[model samples]
Target: MKVNIPWVVGLTIAALGAAGLGGQTARVPGSDADPASCAAGSGRITIATGNSTGVYYVMGGALARLVNGHTDVRAGAAETGASVQNIRQLVAGDYDVAFSLADAADAAVRGTSPFGEPQKIRTLGRIYPNYTQIVVRADSGIRTVADFKGKTISTGSPLSGTEAIATKLIDAAGLDELDVNRQRLDLTKTVDGMKDGSIDGLVWSGGLPTSALTDLYTTLGSEDLRMIDPTPLLPEMKKKSAVYDTATIPKATYDLPADVPTIAVPNVLLVRDDMPANLACALTTLVYDNRQALGAAHPAGKDIRVDEADRTAPIRLHPGSERALAGLTSR
Candidate 1:
C-alpha cells in the first residue's frame, strides 16, 4: 500500500532549508520550517541493539559513537531482542534508529511476517550481509546442515530476525522446527548453553568476525567447533523466504576447513516516517561524510560509504535521505 502524505510536506522542507533547521524537529525540504526551533543535541538517543555478544550490539554502539562524534547528536546503544523488537521500539518512538535484517525490514514495510500491520519506516541504506552462522560442536557429527535433526539448537530470540531466518533455513533443509530441540535465546545465552552442553548447535544471523562468536570458539578451544556452510540449502530457503541469498565468510575468520558457504540477509538503518526531513537528511549525510572517522571507531563502520547509502534491499528510500544523496552528488 502507498503512504498518504499531506500536500504540505513540500512547503515544510523548503522552509527547513531557509531556516537552517537542525536535529529531529527540522522541517522537510520545500516546506516551511517549523517556526519553533529544534535543538541539535539536547537529548541523547538510545539505540536498541541485539545480544551483548553479537555484532548488532557491537555495530550499534559503534554507530552511536560515530553519530555522536561527528554531529551535535549524543547517543548510546542498548542490548535488545533485535529485529522485531528493534523495529517495534523504533516505531514506538523509543529508538531513533535500528539495526535490522533485510527480511525484517521488508516485512515491516509489507506488513507481513510477524508484524500485525503496516508500519511507517524508511531505510537509510543496506549494510553488509548477516550470514546465517550454523555452528556445531565437532563431536556432534553435524557436518551437514540437515544433521540438525533431533539436535538441540538455539535458533534465536523469539520473533527475532535471526529466528525468522533460522526457522526458514531449518525448513529448507527438510527439517521441521519440531524435529529439533529449538531453543529461543540471544547469542550470549546461546553461547553459554552451547558451552554447558545444553545446546548441540546454533544458527545465528550476524556479520562476519563476530566478537562473541570469536570468544565462544576460542573459549571452547577444541577441534569440535565448526561453522557448517548452508549454501547447499539456498534454493529451498528462497522458496520459503525470498530474503535468503548466498554469501561467503572467508576462511581467515575462524581458520575453518575452507571458506564457509552461507545464506545472507541485508541489514538496514531504519527511521520513523514522522521524523523531520532535515534531521533525517543530516543523519544520512553524517554516515557517509564522516564514514572514515566512524570506521576508526569500529570495523563495521567501514561498511558504510556515500557510494552505498542507497543499497538497502526491498525498501524505499526516505525523501530526506534522497535529498542528502542528491546534495552529495551535486558536489
Candidate 2:
C-alpha cells in the first residue's frame, strides 16, 4: 500500500544548478538582459506537484531537473495535495510554480467559491490531461456513480484536485456528497482500504500509467476490480466547466480487461504574475526545449508539447512565458 515517490525530494535538487540555455542574449519582456547570460544569477523556485503515485509528481521532478540542468534556475519539486492546494500555496508564495487541473485553475481565475477572490495567477502552459479513474471492487455492486450513494469511497486527499472532481462527478450523477460515505485519504491509504474491503471504490485524477492504480489492479486482479464508466455524467460535468472532456483509459493501460470510458481535464503549470520575467522565460524555455529529459523521467512529460503551450485561455499566459514562447516563435 505504500506509494513511493519516484525520487527523493529535498534541498539537493535545488542546489544542483545547471548553466543557462546557451544561446543569444535573451530579450524577454521584463528585461533586456539575455536570459542565457543570467542563468547563474537566477533565483530558486519550487514546483508543486501531486501525490507520489501520480504523473504530476514524476514529471514535476523531471521539469525541475530540466530547469536545473538547462537554465540558471535552481528548482525543486514538492509533493502536494494537487490542484486546489497547489494553487493556494503558489499564490501564497509558498511555491514558485504549481501543477493544477484546468477546472481548478479556471475557478481560481474566476473568483469561484474555493477562491474567495480572483487570484492573480498566470499559466506557463497546458501540459497534459488528468484522466479520471474510478476503480471499485467488482463485488461491491456499484456499477455507476449513482450506486455510490451510502457506499464508502475514497475521494483522494482533502484539497486535492481528485477530491474536487470526485465531488463533481458525484453531483453529475445526480447524487449528493452527504449521501455517500466519503473517505478523504491519500492514494496509499485508499489502496489499502480497497484491498481490505473498507473502501468500495476510489476516484483518482492523474496522467496515464499512474503507478498507484497499477498496483491496485495488479494486486486485486482484473476480475476482482472493475472500472466504472464516467461517460454517463460527462454532459453534466461539462456544464460545470468546459475543461471536462471524454477520454479513454486504454485497455493496454493498467492492463484493464477493456477500454474504460472516462472524463479528463487538462493540467496547467502556473506561476504568480509577479514572477521575474527572465526566470519565467528561462523556465518555460527549459520545459519545452529539453522535454526529452522530462520524458525520460516520466511518460507524461512527453505530452508537454509546444502546440498546447498557449491553450491556457481565461488565465493569461505569464509575461515571462509569453516572452519565452515569443522568442521560440521568432526563431
Best by TM-score: 2
Across residues 145-211, which tens digit of lDDT does each residue of candidate 2 receive? 9999989999999999999999999998888789999999999899999999999999999988888
Candidate 1 residue spans exceeding 4 A from truth: 1-44, 329-331
lDDT of each: 0.74, 0.82
Shift in Å, residue 25, candidate 1: 13
Cα misplacement distance, residue 275 of candidate 2 (Å): 0.6
Query: Candidate 2: lDDT over CA atoms?
Result: 0.82
Off by over 4 Å in 2: 1-40, 329-331
- Residue-wise lDDT of candidate 1 within 155-260, one digit each (tens)? 8998788898888778888887789889998888989888888889999888777877887877885476988888888888777557678888887776666787
lDDT: worst 10-residue window of model 1: 4-13
Candidate 1 global CA lDDT score: 0.74
Per-candidate TM vs. native? Answer: 0.83, 0.88
Worst 10 residues of 2 by lDDT: 21-30
